[model samples]
Target: MENKSEEKGITRRGFFQRILVGFGLIISAGATGAIASQLLKSLMPSGWFGEPYVYRKVYAAPITEINQVGASIIFEDKANNRKAILINNGGNIQAFSLVCTHLGCQVFWEKERGKFLCPCHTAVFAADGSVESGPPEKSLDQYPVEIKDGLVYISFREPTWQPEQYFRGEGL
Candidate 1:
């Protein structure tokens, strides 16, 4: 057989076709990466609210009346430690960390705004601890609160940036 190379020399057409294939591959890979990134972001937990800690006491004011207008109440935990606000907005009773998720700034209830407000950056949160506006990319970590025997209970896991197995109910 004569040198096959003579007939099979890479032509401009072949070269252009190969370039197109490579470009297509690159674009496909980039799209896949973007999709994966979005999926991971959606799957990852933004933060952790610690375990439930219940407080049993007869409040000077009803839980409904106190938190109805968005007031932060400091109540003693089972361990008698001073903790953040325990809010009861109408039918929803949610306990959120007063500390801002962004920079540890104290967040407070603004009845006028109908949400929690962070003065440092004007971050606002709905009654359910979801970020309404501002720089916060994640919602507030929510603790499981239950009402038992006319008392309020708050449950939360410690705050964490990196996800841990314990937080995912792996060993929990």
Candidate 2:
């Protein structure tokens, strides 16, 4: 065996040395991968992959088109999986979440009654989101409304920072 290895130019010592070097390279590669993963994680922005709640413009309608007071317009936010009601009350525009506070049922805009009525439990919320009747103890959730450039933009989430102009309507 010794003569055969010597003829092949590979000694027992060299074989063990190559095995150790192979293990060292494997260990170094693992360490390098770990370091790179940590570096990438630190460099990435916070909440980049997380579901951070953000105030997004859910509905936009021209002010001139909203002409009727006490009339409610329903806007569904598919991105946030929620619904909102935009009401023009005496020229003052306001928005409220359509999810009933009592049992999370979808509430309907009762234009005749001038309130949001949840048919699930008969919970009634006034146009101002105040509780009118039924099992609901708290008022309906109100979203912030911004009127910019003759357009009404409604946001369902509370913004962490100042939101940029969402509705840019040159002809609208």
Model 2: colliding residue pairs: none
> Lowest-scoring 10 consecutive residues by lDDT in candidate 2?
162-171
Which whole-number lDDT from 0 to 100 does residue 149 have in model 2?
84
Q: lDDT by residue for model 1 over 1-172, one digit each (tens)?
A: 3333456686666778899999999999999999998887777556234434443333322455454545556554444333556765665766766778888787877766668899999999887788889999888766666666566666644433424555667645
lDDT for position 133 in model 1:
91
RMSD of 1: 9.9
**Which runs in model 1 stand beyond 4 Å of their true positions?**
1-82, 156-172
**Whole-model lDDT for model 2 versus the true structure?**
0.78
Q: Tell me how far the alpha carbon of residue 30 in candidate 1 is from the true structure, in angstroms, after superposition.
A: 40
TM-score of each: 0.47, 0.57
Error of 2 at 137 (Å): 1.3
- Angstrom error of the Cα, residue 149, model 2: value is 0.9
**Candidate 2, residue 30: how far the Cα is off, in Å:** 29
